[model samples]
Target: MPQLTQTEMFLAVLVAIFALPYAVWRLGRTDYYAPLVVVQIVGGILLGPGVLGAALPQLHATLFTPDVIAMLNGIAMWAVMLFVFVAGLELDLKAAWRWRGETGTTAALAFTTPMALGALVAGALLLLDARGEWVGAEGQDWQFVAGVGMACAVTALPILVLFLEKLAILRQPLGQRVLRYASLDDLAIWGVLALILLDWERVGRQAAFIALFVPAVWAMRAAMVRLAERDRWYVALVWVALLGLAADWSGLHFMVGAFLAGAVLDGEWFGTERVDRFRDTVLLALMPVFFLSTGLKTQWSAGGWAVAMFALALLVASVGGKLGGVALAGRLLKWPRGEARLIGWLLQTKALILIIFANVLLDKQVITPATFTALLLCAVASTMLTIPFATPALRQLDTHRA
Candidate 1:
């Protein structure tokens, strides 16, 4: 047998990613709730340092040497950038604005409630940290606690889009309503993240980025509007790369820039089908790398039981907060009975966006690797709970209405 070269090893990873998720999706028939992406994420954790590597050190080292991991990270970063870009593009901010009163009420409640609950969880975790292993090295206390809390509040709009499609509501009025709330929350998520990540030494650079972003966005949007559809795709990738660079230089993240890059452009200009196919293709081809890389970062240093316990606590906060927040809105706005429960279940879905949020927190040293693993587990569980819980609730509402 030949020793596998770098390319060969990476190819094997690709094969595992594509094959394992599909296999699980097919065999387990988890399409309703877990979905293919969730399966892929779970598979990544299984293949990561905490699980597979711990169990089989020699094989893990052979396959995921520093060089291999670096190569994989490169792919994962780009894949996630594109994924985030598509998320920004799909954010129907115009719709959110048009329905400002209700959207604002719902978005405000949905985001802030979970955040408050998550912060309480974070505060509790901080108390149990005998060695200070749960928080970031450079991050201030408030930042770590609040960042973790915001992560709990997040909704993975991309995954939510996919989930709603599975529920046969993607194009329905209810789906659009859900999207509007999520979109507003998405903006707030990033905005608060920027504040949390502010670097005083580089404050000027960050300010300059914002100043330039305005005209840059205007120019870019104009170009996107003028270009042929064929040209827009390639140009859009270039724009993602460019804005991503600017964002990183400005003491913010490239992912934030990638989102801004797409946010500036109109979704209508790119055509819905094109946007859909591009997103699907990116997810199919590249996002597995992101998941695997994320898994590689997971560590069980906090003790598995402790991590699990904290994770369950966070999960309750996330689900309970989101549901409670939305329910508050439903009551205030006089929504039909049961609508709030159905909407709350849908809003609680979290995967890509929360993972992305947590990854940044980890990168900025706002959270420890063990804390990240706990949050990752929480995200997986929350996502898995969405469809199963929402489907019956939605049906009961429909039946009651009938």
Candidate 2:
């Protein structure tokens, strides 16, 4: 293996750290949340082995390493946590409680229907395309199937919030309902993923440990919230550090701990404004580094027919399952027809959360390089499709209500 010279490494870091923020800042002027992903992807490609290697081959080798990859994963997890915490902060717990009846039904339908459909679709794809007979640890069959199912059933609540805010609809009745549903959707999907991970014999014990660790950390957070309420900054620091440590100790990713900490402190220790400030700083600073890291790690050449089939299965299951389930639930619950269809479509958009979960599966070796790349492509495509499909419906509804 070749090592990068000191100069090359320093330049790579400088490009990752500086270039992303400048791009984000410029993008923020037009659409505060829209351009970060695009910019980071472009930045990564520019700094990555593909482009950089073609230009300055030496710098490329130095920047790619196990250590650097791990750092990128950590940063990605943190970015995800910050994003999820922001989502939690935006949740109207009160409204969620009020709509508990409808919300519960919608959530159950949304999670179960998509998950089951995704699993079935994935299984069929594996049978058709996969080489091996048994699809397990050796074959990577179960992992691919589960990954597709998860991608299909998942929703990025944070992205949904960003969309709502961009449209200036956060406080509207329909927006409020969508927000609450998205929150419930996230909780349900994550819980299901945790359960699925636990079912894996190799990592079952570790998953069990993390599951048990949640409440224990919640107890600690309960104490920290009381103490931090007195001195906000001190408490925030302590909370963040403790959360990161707990997640590490529990054999779970740090972002899980960060999100749980945020949830525990939500509405109690940190107010919306302060949380917003912290998020903006983190987004502007560390989040871009994380996305660039993912972009840097992604290799399109790894993809094959098997991966292509898996990605297609995920894309279809996610859209069809979520849309069909939500639509059915809406009619069954007697929601307005248009409103029901819109909700279904909106909930199908997958972005940050899908990427985060795909990384997790990748780390666990549950997804191959090719499969992971395909899933990322699927997420980007689905998110792009979402805006065009949902925007008109949302606008029409707004006009009707007015």
Task: Indicate which candidate wins on lDDT.
Answer: 1
The regions of model 2 sitting more than 4 angstroms off are 1-8, 11-13, 16-34, 38-59, 62-81, 84-94, 129-143, 199-218, 221-225, 228-233, 240-244, 301-309
lDDT, candidate 2, 43-81, per-residue tens: 654665545656787656667655666666576666666
Write out the backbone clash pairs for model 1. Answer: none
lDDT of 1 by residue, 1-402 (tens): 989999899888788878988998999898877888999899999999899999999999999988889999999999999999999999999999999999999999999999999999888877876427788787888998888789889999988898888889889998899999999999899888988989898999999999999998888877887899889989999999999999999988888899888888888888999899999999899998999999999999989998898789999999999999999999999999999999999998889988888888888888889889989999999999999998998899889889
Listed in order, each prediction's TM-score against the native is 0.98, 0.81
Instruction: Determine which window of 10 residues in candidate 2 has minimal summed lDDT.
Output: 130-139
Q: Which ranges of candidate 1 are over 4 A from the true structure?
A: 129-131
Model 2: per-residue Cα lDDT at residue 154: 82
